[model samples]
Target: MVQSNHETIRMNPNIQEKPETLTKLFIRKFKKNKLAVLGAVVLLIIILSALLAPWIAPCNPGQTNLANKLAPPGADHWLGTDRFGRDVFSRLLYGGRISLLVGFGSVAGALVIGTTIGAVAGYCGGIIDAILMRFVDIVISIPSIFLLITIVAIFQPGVEKLIFILAITSWTTTARIVRGEFLSLRTREFVLASKTIGTRPSKIIFSHILPNAMGPIIVTATLLIGTVILTEAALSYLGLGVQPPTPSWGNMLEDAQNFTVLLKAPWYPAFPGLMILITVLCFNFVGDGLRDALDPKGNL
Candidate 1:
C-alpha cells in the first residue's frame, strides 16, 4: 500500500494538495488574460490618481490665467493649459473624480433598483411579474438618450442630478437581465429544497438565488459604468452637465469645442477624449475578464 501511495504521489504531486479557493482561481484566471491584467493596472493607477488629486495635483483645477492660456505641454503643465489657462494635467485628475463618481454612483443606484424589481417580479411568477415586466418593456421602448436629454433640459444638471437621472433611466436593462436570471434559477433543485424546508421567501430570493445570479450582475454593472461615463460626457458636451468652475471630464471636452482652440491646440480636445476612450476600453477589458472568470465551465 505504501509503495502504491508513493507511486501515486510521484505521478501527481498535487494529489494531496488542497483545492484552490474560488477567489484564488478567479485571480489566477484573470491574470492569465494579458489585456485584462493591463487594463486592471492602468485603471487602478487612474483611480488612485483621481482619488489623490487634492494632494498630488500641482495646481488648482479652477485657477485660470489668460496669459498662460493655450500653452503647449511643458514642465509646468504636463498636458498643457486649457483655454482658461487651467493646468490640463490637474484638471484631468480632478475631472476623473467627477466622471468616476457619476459612473459608479449611477450604476450602483441602477443595480439596486433594477435588482429589487426584477427579483420580486421573477420570483413571484404571476400578476406581479406581468405588471413589472410590462413596465420594463414600456420603459425600454423609449429612447434612453432622448429621455435623458429631455430630463436634463427640464432640470438643471449637477453631478447628483445626473447620477440620479442616469440611474432611473438605465435600470430597465439591469431589470431584464436580473429577471431572466431569476426566472432560470428559481426552478432549480436547491431553490425547491429551500422552499420545502420553509425558508422565508425573502431569504430564499436574497440569499439563495441572488448569490448564484451575481456573476451576470457584476459584469453588467462594470459595463454600465463605462456607458454612464459616456452619457455624462455627452450631456456635458451639450452644455447641460457639470457646470463651470466644477471640472468634469465631460465639461472639459465642452471647453475644448471652440473652433479656434481646436485648431490652435489639438491637444485640448484630445486629452479628455483620450481619457474617455481609455477608461471605457479598460472597463470593457475588465468586464470581459470577469465574465470569463465567473463562468463555471471556463474554470473546468
Candidate 2:
C-alpha cells in the first residue's frame, strides 16, 4: 500500500502549497485585529456619506432658514440648525468632504516633500545629508501655528490653501521619519548590490530603496491624516481656516467659538467634536494595526 514515497510525490504535485507573499501576510495579520477592522468599516461609512452628500443630504449646507435658527435635532432638520439656521446635518455631511479632503491632500503633499528630501539625504550621504537634515531641523524649530496663520493670511482661507498650509507646516516630522528609514536601508545588502550593478541612482533610490522603506512611510501617512485634521481644527480656532459658507469640520467647531453656543445649542458643537474624535481614533487604530501587520517579525 505504501509502495514508494517517491512515487507518491511524483503523483501528488497538487499537494504542495505556494509560499505566502508579503502582501497576503500583511492582510492576514491586519484582519486579526478586530478593532482595526471595525474602525475601518465605520470610517468607510463616514467617507461614503461625505461623498454622497449631494444625494443624501436633505438640503444644501449653505441654505439658511432664519426662522429655524438653532432648531433642535428633529425630522425637519436632523442634527438641528446652527446659528445661521443652516442644516447642521447637511453641513456635517458636506463638511466631512472638506475635512477628509484636507486630510488627504495635506498628507499627500507632505509625503511628497518629505519623502523626496529624505530619500535624497539618505542616498547621497556626506554634505548633502548633513545639509538637508539641518534644513529639516530648522523647519522643525519654526512655530507651526504661526507659519500656518501667516500662510493663510496671505493666501486666504480655503480648502486648497489650508491643505497646502498644513502640508508645509507638518512635513518636518515625516521628513525626519523617512530620513531615518532611508539611512537604515541605504546600507543594506540589496542597496549595495544595486549600486554595484551600476543601476541608475534614481532607480536605486526609488525602485530598490523606496519600496523597502514604504512600510513606515505608509504608517506615518495614516497617522498624519489625523494630525492634519487636528491642525486644521486648531487653525479654525484662530480664524485661519476654511471660511464660512464652506462646510468643514474645523469651521464647524469654529461655530462653537462663542461660549454661549455651547450652552444654548450643545448639539451644534457636540456633533462636530464627536466626528473629530471618531475620525482621529479610527485612523489611529488603523495605523497601529498596519504597523503591527507590516512588521517582519509578526506571525505569518
Candidate 3:
C-alpha cells in the first residue's frame, strides 16, 4: 500500500512538474538561433576592434601623408589611403567607435524618455493617455529624416547634438510599444494582487509590471540601435552629422563621393558601406532572435 502511494505521487502531473525560469527558457530558445549567434559574435568583434583601435591601428587616422594620397592597398597600407592620405584602415576603426557610440547613446536616451512616458500614460489612462498618445501621433506624422536635417542645419552639428536630436525624434515607436505592453499587463492577476495588498501604485508599476514587460522593450531597443546608427550615418553622409575631420563611417563615405575617387579607389567607399550593412544586419538578427526566444508560444 505504501509502495502504491509512492508510485501514485510520482505519477501525479503537478508533483512531477519542473517549471523553468523565464530567463533559462529564453536562453535555451536563443541558443537554437544560428544566425543570431553568428550576429552576436560578429558584433562582439566589431565592438572590441573599435575599442582597441588606438592599439591596433597601423597609422594615425588623422595624420595626413600627402605623398601617399590615394595609395592602393599594400603591406604598408592594408586598406589604402584616402584623398588626404589618411589611412583607411585606421579611420574605419576610429569611425566605428563614433558610430557605435551614437547608436548606443541615442537608443539609451530614447529608451529612458519613451519608457517614462509610456509607463505614466499606460498606468494613468483616461485623459492623460489621450493627451500623451495624441502628442505621440503628432510627432509620428512628421517625416523624421527631414526633421533631423532641419534641426541639424539650425544647430551646430556635433556628436552630442546629433545624439540628442536622434533620441528626441526616435522615441515614439518605443513609447507605443511600451504603452501597449503596460496596457495589457496592468490588469494581470499579479498586478491586481499587488493592488489588493495595498502596494504603492508606483511600486507596483515599476517593480511588478515593468519587469514583466521588459522582454518586448529590450527587443525593441536592440532593433532601435540599428535604426539610430543608420540615421546618424545618413546625417553624416549629408555633411551635417559628425562634421569634417571627425572619422564617422558616414563622413568617411562623404569624403569618398568624388567621381574620380569612386572610379579610381573603390576601397574608400566600400569598406565603410560594408561595415554599416554588417552592423545593421547583425543587430536586426539579434532582435529577431530575442523576440522569438521571449515568446512563450514557441512562435518565431
Best by TM-score: 1
62-145 per-residue lDDT for model 3 (tens digits): 999989999999999999999999999999999999999999999999999999899989988999999999999999999998
Off by over 4 Å in 3: 1-19
Q: In candidate 1, what are the lDDT values of residues 242-295, reduced to their tens digit?
A: 887898899999999999898999888999999999999999999999888888
Model 2 global lDDT (CA atoms, 0 to 1): 0.88
- TM-score of model 1 (CA atoms): 0.94
Residue runs of model 1 more than 4 Å from their true location after superposition:
1-15
Ranking by TM-score: 1, 3, 2
Pairs that collide, model 3: none
Kindly list the per-residue Cα lDDT of model 2 for residues 1-300, writing each as its tens digit: 775755766799776555779788888999998888888898999999999999999998999888888889999988999988899999999989988999999999999999999999988989999999999989888887777788899889888878888887777777888888888988899989988989999998899899988999999999999888888887876778888888788899988777777787977898988999999999989999898898898776
Q: Give the CA lDDT, 0 to 100, for residue 220 in model 2.
A: 95
In model 1, how large is the Cα lDDT of residue 4? 77
Q: In candidate 3, how many Å is residue 89 off? A: 0.7
| TM-score, every prediction | 0.94, 0.92, 0.92
Better of 1 and 2 by lDDT: 1
